[model samples]
Target: METKRFYQQRLDEWVEESRKQAYKGRVAEYIPGLAAAPQHALGIALWGTDGQFFQSGDTDLHFTMQSISKVFSLLLALMDSGEKSVFQKVGMEPTGDDFNSILKLELVDPGKPFNPFINAGAIVIASLIQGDGPDEKSERLLQFIRHLAHDNRLDYNEAVYESERETAHRNRSIAYYLKDNGVLEDDVEETLEVYFRQCSIVVNCKQLAHMALVLASDGVDPVTKQQVIPRRYVQIAKSFMVTCGMYNASGEFAIEVGLPAKSGVSGGILSVVPGKWGIGIIGPALNSKGNSVAGVQLLRHLSQDWDWSIF
Candidate 1:
């Protein structure tokens, strides 16, 4: 096992080597707040189940969770509604389409979302969260995230939330379509509000890494040794992460990096070297399929150098 000193010595060199790939991608612009991010910025943090920690580059830089929030929301939904109820709203299989594509919702029988990591499925999962209204639901989800991250101060980036809410025509359309198809039980706008707020939750790489660490330990907090989430739900979440987390590039990532991971449009990725480390990365530049270009490169390098691939 590599010591913390060894990681600290080499992490910066690895990060800079990976930063060069940022030139090949661009920041997401559909959301005004996200477009303002530095296109070349790259950062990473790693937290080990054995209590080792290492970080490099823009690790302190804060960004919205974007689609990465879907992972936690899915977990919370499973806890609230159980596997049977949650699966009734979203499928376990990946769609291979763009994360926001609604084509399958129209053509697929039952008209349900293919998986929770996608926008449509995430919206459906949001409705499954137990609460009397959107505000309560959003708060409950945020509290769950805070608990997983072990940080009580974590909260929303309201600017990003408003920006997403204003420009989310496609998401709005998908929600309404699901409503018409008998898939959505809550009010369209209310469920969408919860989904938007969850995506807008602000977090740094370190905080994200901590959250991933819980999953790496099978829903246990390494420091406290407490079961933060049920093991079965963590297994379910990790399976989805492997198959559908990186938008349409999940298969490629699974083959190359071989770790369960989730990526967000804000250029954040939460990945796990199961039973070992939880990794968080932020590189605002995105490839055509909406994943962090430099972040993925960095993970590829580390996975190869350290043989971190679970496969």
Candidate 2:
């Protein structure tokens, strides 16, 4: 309980400190919906293996998951298609380019994506989720995320989804390229629909923390003690999160935070301190690498303070 009290006190101090970092970054404006968030806002929630839940600062603010959905979608793809099948469509290494870059597909031999977390790779994985159509796949992915969060009310932000769909010229090009290369399992538009809808799934820090707790426990629900995803698949997802989850800034984050963390362009990050805690953070202002500037700094401070490094 002393540790809990200490965490409470430190979180308040850290949140105030981190909030200042947000002013240095810009809110993502590629999609019209994301540009509407308050730039200086920062929030965080933590769910401990010991059943302690603590939250501070703007924790109730809702935002889309954005690229963070790739983690869960990759897990669902593995569950549906198995590792061999999933790996066949996407490579395991990280691409040093931007998450949506298409140049690597032409230069990187065999033409598969460098990893599942990137946009090109995620689109292929989206096609692998078993469904009769885009709507069904989107529903299945949402249900899986809801099951993890233990909140059936979780759903997509239609306005965001529509905005993403409308402005997805680069994503559309990637899908078409994948289709031309014969990597997509379904129609290009359909697969992109699933990808866009998943990215639009709205979440707050509390729900994100609960969902991340499943990954922290290695696919087991900490509260229910049930295996929600196979251990091996969770291992794969976490590995990807470590190496590629922060987009081009993953190596820097790994060196500083030293935990498996996936960040979204919407300024949301889902981090796992394996067997100890699940953390969720949101700060609408983003750094150049499409990650939350304030949220990333806060994680660095927490990781150093708690000595949570996996390395």
**The best candidate in terms of TM-score:** 2
In order, candidate lDDTs are: 0.94, 0.94
Q: For residues 23-91, what per-residue lDDT tens digits would candidate 2 score against the true structure?
A: 889999999989999999999999988889999999999999999999999999999989999988899
Task: Give a tens-digit lDDT track for model 1, residues 1-311.
Answer: 55767877678888998899999999999999899999989999999998888899999899999999999999999999999999988998999999999899988875799999999999999999999999999999999999989899999999999999999999999999999999998999999999999999999999999999999999998878989899999999999999999999999999999899999999999999999999999999999999999999999988988999989
Tell me the spans in candidate 2 whose CA falls farther than 4 Å from its real position: none
Q: After superposition, how far is residue 300 of candidate 1 from its true place, in Å?
A: 0.4
Residue pair clashes in candidate 2: none
- Candidate 1 deviates by what RMSD? 1.2
Quality of model 2 by C-alpha lDDT: 0.94
TM-score against truth, every candidate: 0.98, 0.99
